[model samples]
Target: MSAFGKDGVTGLYETHLPVARLERAIDFYENRLGLERAYTNDERRVAFFWVGGKQSGMLGLWETGTAPLGMRLHFAFHASEEWLLDGCSRLRDAGISPLGFHGEAVEEPVVIGWVPAMMLYFKDPDGHSLEALHVLPQPPDRAFGIRSLTAWRQYAS
Candidate 1:
């Protein structure tokens, strides 16, 4: 018999990102973005945060000082539209700007034209791009295919 679930596989376990400084990155994620720091190790210079709450999701930040400047990465967390708006405000209140899907600074989350989701993109202090996402209900009329991020709200229409 299978030791795991009835299905073949399971969900994602965790995600990791690299940063330049451990302390600053901690502040950016814990204080600025509201993630709870779950663990840290100085010898490894790594920190882990509970993304949605304790044991719900995991994010790891590893300090690597020798990487090239302007290194970029992307990560997304599931959120509601209300949370997305409030999150944008939180970033603004911290003097950080929110970004549209195309990477342009914006005041609100963009409704991706192709997918059934809304997204707000921004970067952490280490320049790793992040997204706050809200998946929408599928239209009852018909199905759609992958499309561009812009005007995603109208895909089902």
Candidate 2:
């Protein structure tokens, strides 16, 4: 018998990001990332964007003070490889830097060796770290170890 039980928890419902300004954040998510502006409230200083769907894939941006220096929050969206690549190209074409794990300009997608997920990362106008990842469809190996992006490249060398 499996140890796992039905916890009524299956997948992500929604996520929120704090920003210093609402309108700029809304523009970034909408114009920059092409997310649909589902809702907005200037009084509440909040904007909600539909990432993929109206119900589940919702991302909210709320106006708040900036985080303390060196403090950052990170989140990721599950994307197909094609979608991620297209997004990278789009952002880069708009003169935005496509970032990887180190938050630097990405020459290529960073491959997470453990989960074997291919991912790309970037920052919002508020400096919020965001990522797009594609988890490879493959079973895990029993003998496993984690490797950094640079280190993982050694295997292919």
- The lDDT values for all models are 0.77, 0.74
Model 1 lDDT per residue over 33-138, tens place: 8888999999999999998777578999999878476466888988877787576787798767888877887766666534567777888988888888887675
Q: Can you give the lDDT of residue 59 in candidate 2?
A: 91
Reference-based TM-score, model 1: 0.79
Q: Any residue pairs clashing in model 1, and if so which?
A: 112-152, 113-149, 113-151, 113-152
lDDT per residue as tens, model 2, 39-105 = 8888888898887778658998888856664335788988887876576687787556788777777
Task: Provide the global lDDT of candidate 2 against the true structure.
Answer: 0.74
Looking at candidate 2, the ten consecutive residues that score lowest on lDDT are 140-149
What are the per-model numbers of colliding residue pairs?
Answer: 4, 0
Compute the lDDT for candidate 1: 0.77
Clashes, model 2: 0
In candidate 1 the C-alpha lDDT for residue 18 amounts to 87
